[model samples]
Target: MLIKSEQQLLNFIKYSPIIIITLIAILINSLIYIQNEQNFEKDLEIYKKNYIESNKRLTKFQVEKAYKDIQRERENLEHRLENRLKTRVQEVYLTVENLHKKYSHLEEKELLNIIKESIRTIRFNDGRGYFYIAKKNGFSILHPITPEYENNDVSKLKDSFGNYLYKEIIDHFKTEEEYFGELKAVKPNMGNKKFEKVTYIKLYKPLDIIIGTGEYKEDFNNEIKNHIIREHIQNVRYGKNGYIFIFDYDGYQLAHVKKEYIGKQRIDLVDSNGFMITKEIIKQAKKEPGFISYIGSIMPETGKPAYKTTYIRGVDDWGWAIGSGFYNLDMLKYLEAKKKELRAMNNESLKKTLIISLILSAILIALAFYISNILKNFFTRYHERIENEIQENRKKDMVLYQQSKMASMGEMLGNIAHQWRQPLSSVSTIASGTKIQKELGMLDDKEFDKGMETIVKTTKHLSQTIDDFREFFNPNRVKKEVDTQVIYNKAIQLISSRLTSKEIELKSDIDSTVFVTYENELLQGLMNILNNAIDAFENKEIKNRIIKFDIKFQKECKMPNCDIKECSQGKEGYITITIQDNAGGIAKEHIDKIFEAYFTTKYKSQGTGIGLYMTYEIINKHLKGFINVENSEMKHDTQSYKGAKFTIILPINIEEG
Candidate 1:
């Protein structure tokens, strides 16, 4: 049966590696696959985000460029109208100049009459166009309106903008051959309100007269604006299916590719998705320039609605809403392409991971086989080697144990000697001095009494110290009749200096003659508890540090949820000893392990970690007692303090352990 058990153990050791390595290889590959799958999902989302953001930025740029162009075109329209007026005035001036030369022999006034009659019926600029004649001396040769100024001082005329109309004209002719400017005048069948007009005049030097024609500036502005909307705005294009569109605040389309919709109210027009696209554009344009989005016309490339993101700006001066937009393509094809690339990358990664896993498994398997063969060879000679080792260890262990015992004894003796050195030296000095004083007949009674008292106290302390140390290693264990109060006093005396030095206050309700048994062991445990409390206060910076000690007789301990069977140890009654302190508290994480050997919260130099362990052993093993520790809160003098409490429960009716 032993051989079979050994064989089974050997079999397990020899074959387990291959199985473990295979499992590890499978796990590695599985992890790689899962990680790749997650990465693909993340990459897909990132691609979609970047693609849409890029297109949005592109459309914004295009729309802004178109908006600037519209602004620039509006400025250019003014200059365009000015040039047209200059050209038309030159044509009329030349035509009149030719007639004046042909009829120079006729009266100058008759030639002026002929020029006016020939050009009177011709009209342009929305029928607000007409020709006029003026003499070189600022006299109206042919006044188109206000015939009262036909032969009088026309220089006194003022336009609606308060310009000295003929004065400016005569002033320009004095230095220049022609004049082109803006002024105001009434027109044929027009109201007496002087309408603002653009006038162009040229000096006809042959007759000492000025030939000019004028057009209403308001009418010219409207014509130029309409021409721009029809020609330039309608033709402007950017990205695929991108175009500039214009609409009035009333939602009438002014310039759009949908020619049927031009000049028609489009507020009711909706996209294929039934979204009122024109109404939304107009609404946003009313507030400020901003971007709006809706489903728009279908894309020719893909028969789906090309989503439109349009930027609308309100030209409040013109009472028009101008906008341009670019369409977004369907993403199905783009995502399909990205998916193929992702698959290719995942395939490559998986191949690499598998190859590396296989290589690692092969190497591990080879090592396993080699080690198993060595194990078999080692097992064949194991009995003889073990026999030799057993003999050698037996000799070595005996030597080491004896050495360790002697070393501990030596340490104990050394401590005793070190402690005794100073007091023994003092005693020797006092005794020798007294003998010398007596020999010299100089020993006084008072001095002699003081020396004797010191000698007696020091000797008693040394004797008590011996009893304490002896109990630590005494081989013979027996129950002795003891005074429990004396044991408690001894424990208190050991740590009294520590408590004093650390300024830790002690409160005791330890009634005398409590049933504390195993005097030496209990003394050691109690001293350990007190010493720990004192040490805890060494790092505290509080002024009212306190440690409370209490002992009592009861049926069971104050531990309401006591797990220990109190009656099993002593059926008569129970004795409980509790020590609590306000040195903050034992850390909750370290509280459970506080009594375990070699477990301490202190730095290496400060604690050996054996104090609590020895206390636990003494109470539980030697005294047949139960011990527990926990964090507790207490109120003293109307002040709250948090600390740790250690409770020890012992059998009141004693017996040998």
Candidate 2:
């Protein structure tokens, strides 16, 4: 019995873990299914909302496109019509003036008769236009359509629309030479109709007659409205059943695809949801042409409550609001189909997931133990690899820095050659003269000594050129106080010969001498900048090549304008060095990139493209100064020239020990 109790306790301990794990797995699966169901519901809601909003935006876009197209057509028509009318009126004016000139020599009655007869026969614009004569006092002398009104004072004649036709014409002609008006007028073969006419009046001073002719606008338009309605508006279709419909701003339905709905008042019409559809559409249209939405109009195929999105636009010329609509039933149908598909997929996936989860649950326990041990080794190796990569990167940076320094040294060598050429030529010339003097029997002791002294001085200058550049490339980090003026002059001396060769004048001003560390690097940077200016003058036809340096002292601050912010807080001032050159300035596109490594505007053979880049890095990093470059009009003395200005803001001496 004791052995049996001990065995039973061992069995219970071994099986208890499996039983508890199975229960937890069941509970976790149930929670996962519930959470997945909730997430699917949330996602479906979001998708439906997003789809509806996107459809609304699409409908608005369609409406605005149509509005722009129609407005453009209207403007084009107005422009053409105005030009045509002016041209037609000018033709009639020239004809009447010629006739008046021809008949002016006859007797008064004869002249009047001849002029009237000549004007009566003239017709233009396909016989729809004719000449008429009127007196300055508003009496009609001739009327082509109405002969009886010619002898009568027809100035007070009112059209069918209560517009005083002749009186308005005479009043307009009193202040202007021409007239364009619309009125009820009699055509030759047709009865009175509203006509827009352009009339021109010529004052015949000799005969005291005002001769004018006008063309009917209806004839000039030539079926433009019908063409626009048929070709432009009616045929323009957008989605499956989308179409344009027109209504006046006051809500009179003028044109629609469904013929029976035309001529109906829609301002008070409501959708199935009781929203005032036409009122909202017209209100939106009357503002700038844009889109408005209202739910109405059922889908014919569905025969259900359908959502419709319409875009509305106003036509100011005809006082009409036009729009098109897209039904949401298509999207709804797609959504419903997708929902059914997703539901089926979810059910299938749930069955598979439950079976798979049971299988995976067993494997997960084994992997948890196995992967932890693997992760420990992986982390150890990963840290070692990262350290190695950092070291490699540091070596690469040093290599790049050395390469850049070599490139700068090569550029300085070119400047050195330019500096030594003149002195070497002078030494050679002096030696040649000394030889010629000895050969010619004119050699004197004092002359020979003077020549020898000059040769020595020139050789010393050549040696000093080498020394200046040799110290520039030294990698020693030595800090010493430097006067700003002295530093500027030293840099200038290195490049002065090259400047002279290019005929570029150097101008400099140093107001206060300030001290800074890394004086040689500063001088090197300044020399590199001056060399660039010198190189820029190559092949340039600037009348006066000039480079300028201006130095001043400015108080430095911890923050911007710290003097006003905190009364007692301050730091040492800065030596501000400005270098400018008049080589027509750097091109604007390349100004920002000039300091970047391997970026140069010069030929590859002429430049290695690291001189200015090293200069920038040296000033900003080694010397702890700020440098900025821009292209602007630099004024030197009395002349203003477009040039590049480089400003170097350098800190004063910081070493205190």
Candidate 3:
């Protein structure tokens, strides 16, 4: 037997190369199969992760997009409702403001009674909104919703949430001039059921009453939200399991995929990681739309705890957060089944892959370097071209501005000529008289003194004229509190000679007390308008060349116009100056183009259109005031004629400090 075994071993060794090659092939096949199997499992895990993430993103997007639409609608309703309420309060303030101005001289008690009666009768928004008044001590003076509460002290009044509603308003006014805030109150139409309401309170200092208005905020939000829920929000759907859920910013669920969870408070609910999931959802939803992953959730299919990935967004208008989510475990089963099939196919592919591995590895390295060089050169050229173009455009703009200023200076010189003519003539006349007196041997001491004084005063007047013009044209960016009337007088003074020579009747109703900033700038702009009106008169044959100034001062207004008389009714503060002329108003076609630079409605010798354009810039850009021109028919002393009217409205007071 030993002899036979030894012979067998020798025979196996004789063919050992062939046997080893066959055995190695089998082992290599097994190793490749195992690696491919491991790779398929790894790929499946990656696919599962990607699949879950994709679902999370899609669900979040759908929920957030739908929530955004609902939120936008809610906001619009809130804005409209709030504005309606605010406008109602403002209108009351205006009426009170007007009455205060109108009855400023009346006895306090009598004025209060008249104002109270007027407020009680006034209604807005088709009688849905009304105004009321309370004293600083929280004494209800005139409440339309709660008449029983009227004539009663409400300093201790509290809302359903235990907030001291009336005391807050009164105390707020102790340190503030105006108050706009929220409060809780009962709705008359809702059977006195408490709802959150917005209130605007202002201390009417004249009557010592905290005047206010209130409207139920929740009622408006609900009406808007219900419309959205019915028409759009509820219909939103994404993946097989995805649906939007709604909750207030405070985490009170309004809508959910699980019907039983709706209307439940979940702000304090935590996930497996102990994170306040609902609170975080509400917080994130209130800002921009985003994704969040938390470990704990109640599964929609099983109604059991599981890891959930959610997407959330807030609807700011209704103070609600809306979101949707999916469970990771649901995706696991599909991934596992897919992985099993993929492993066998991968194992087969791996056997073929080794044949070309060396060839592919050599080509990839060369391709990467070539692509990197090309990208670098392309971006470098692109950046250079963009920067060069920007610099060229900036230079061109600077040149245009300089040319405009130069053109304006040429026009100012002509105004100066007109201004200097009178002073020059007076000085010439005084000198001629003095020379004649000396030549005729009648230059007595008293006569010499009088002639000398007249010449000196005439020369001084010319010097002052030059100073005023120089100061106006100076490029000084200084602002000071200047009376509106002073600026007007200065402007008229600059163009007075031209208006007189043209036989223009200048009538002014200036309230000299109102003050503002940018005195010289305002003067220059007014001068431009005045000069335009004078120029407009040259072609017309109208008899009365009347230029009128109607200036008014108000205490609480902005951007005054003809309609402001009714809108502000002198209840707000503003300064309005209307400079109009009977020069047969500008042609309708040319009115709109009048403010354009280099746009002229005159013979080339008569005007450079830059005057009005510069005037527009000065008033609008420099003084922060509004100036507008219109062609209208005017009546002066029973004579009706057409002309251009320029109205300027500016702030009442500007603080220099």
Candidate 4:
């Protein structure tokens, strides 16, 4: 045999109710903890959705603001270009007007000198050098730096240059308006040398003349191109390790970090080494409105992929698209740092939730088992005390029942004496009549018949009286369906002897057809109430002590008189036995408590309080009927006496099994 060790005993103690409750408390607490964790997860999801939506809205707002800024800058540049062009046109117009006004009245030499001075002024203000004056017959009159061409029919010179200049001047003369064109410039001294130039011609209307000015294309473009590019580049911010490029409307490279690529068309920028990014920038800008990343060859100095974010701005008037681009690698570094911080926070929250859940579950389970043990001990004590009180009450009820039985026995003996009195007196009278008839010796046939009839009637009455008393005192258990009239008749018979001795007149108005399920004990209960009524009347010493027993079907048992289904059984039938006497009525204070056990106004020897209590018990508990009492005043020849009326209301057929 093995003995249990201290550790084994300790283990068993740990598994006891207190310990079990601790475990259960822990389980419930864990459920609560897990629920809190789920709630946190739900909140996190909501935060994430809201965060993403907010970022999207912010991105949209930023893009719209950027687009507006680009539009504003473009508008400003266009406005400046427009003002400069308008001022230049106005100055040329003014110079032509002055030339015509001064030369209108001059001689040929003076007019020639004025034309040369005007050409010099045009050259000074307009950045071009060549000018001429022509007559209506296409003869050249004044030529700056070439005075040999004076009075020459220069219009007839067969070359594109001479034709363009002559036609432009003649057209302006006829229309009296200015004309502009581009043409090749030729001079005899500078043979085979070509000049690309712009011409502005105006008619000398007051003098039938035309004056023309020409500006070289190279000189005019040189004035504005560098300034436009410089202004655009200076405002662009590339941050660090990133570069910017600017492209013109035709996808040509206008400016770039690699300055050598400037002015090169996009298609021609590709080198033998295949290091070009202009085509890639243009392709991305055309695909989307703003910022996209694409890979391309990087400039050699940068040593990074030309993976860039490109932005396009359209020049609406020219149907051109301008673009700017930046490299991609610099933007990613910032996003990576934010992602690491979020992951760290998520891991810390998860670890905290798991640890808290386990601790709480253990605490909750212990509390549950501890409370269960305490409640069990409390209820066990309460039930034991209740059982002891019930047994004590039962003993008192038995003693009271025995006392009631002894009192009934004494009343029964009184009833027997009263019952024997009438029959005995009739027998004595018959015997006396027989003795008198024999002494007189005059017993004729008529006298004999009357005496025998008298004898038979007296004997029959005596036999019926004995039968009624015998049924009342019978001790056998009765289980049978008894008629309502039989029960009432029996009750009257039991009380009849007492009624007669007290000179109380007994009258019955009973229904013959009603029946009920009852025993002799119910009849005895009704007799007891009748007996008390006889006593009350006789003791009061009223002139006429009359007890009326009425048995009939109760049409209305309560208000509205609706038949009770369980009691009436489809017929509006109930037996009401009213026992009224000319006795004094019960006092009002004692009426309600008359049915309570050990509650009576009569002396203890005269009446046990349980008479009506037993009557109520027999009718309600055994016979399934009801009893109530009311006081009524009796009138005899205009004299009224108060009497007690006891009503026994019973079902026509009480159910039995």
Model 1: per-residue lDDT, tens digit, 267-328? 88788788898888888888998888888754535546777777888877777888876565
When superposed on Cα atoms, how far off is each prediction in RMSD?
Answer: 23.6, 27.3, 36.5, 29.7
| Top model number, lDDT | 1
Q: Least accurate stretch of 10 residues (summed lDDT) in model 1?
A: 1-10
Question: Candidate 2, which segments miss by more than 4 Å at Cα?
Answer: 1-29, 90-141, 146-228, 249-252, 263-319, 340-359, 365-657
The RMSD (Cα, Å) of candidate 4 is: 29.7
lDDT order, best first, reads 1, 3, 2, 4
Local error of candidate 1 at residue 624 (angstroms):
48
How would you encode candidate 3's per-residue C-alpha lDDT over 451-508 as one tens digit per residue? 7788788788878888887887788867776776777778887887788878999988
* Alpha-carbon deviation at 279 in model 3, angstroms: 69
lDDT of each: 0.77, 0.73, 0.74, 0.62
* Residue-level lDDT for 84 in candidate 3: 69
lDDT of 1: 0.77
- With a 3 Å backbone cut-off (N, CA, C), the pairs that clash in candidate 1 are none
- Each candidate structure's TM-score, on Cα atoms with residue i matched to residue i, is 0.52, 0.42, 0.37, 0.38
| Residue 260 lDDT, candidate 4, scale 0-100 | 74
TM-score of model 3 relative to the true fold? 0.37
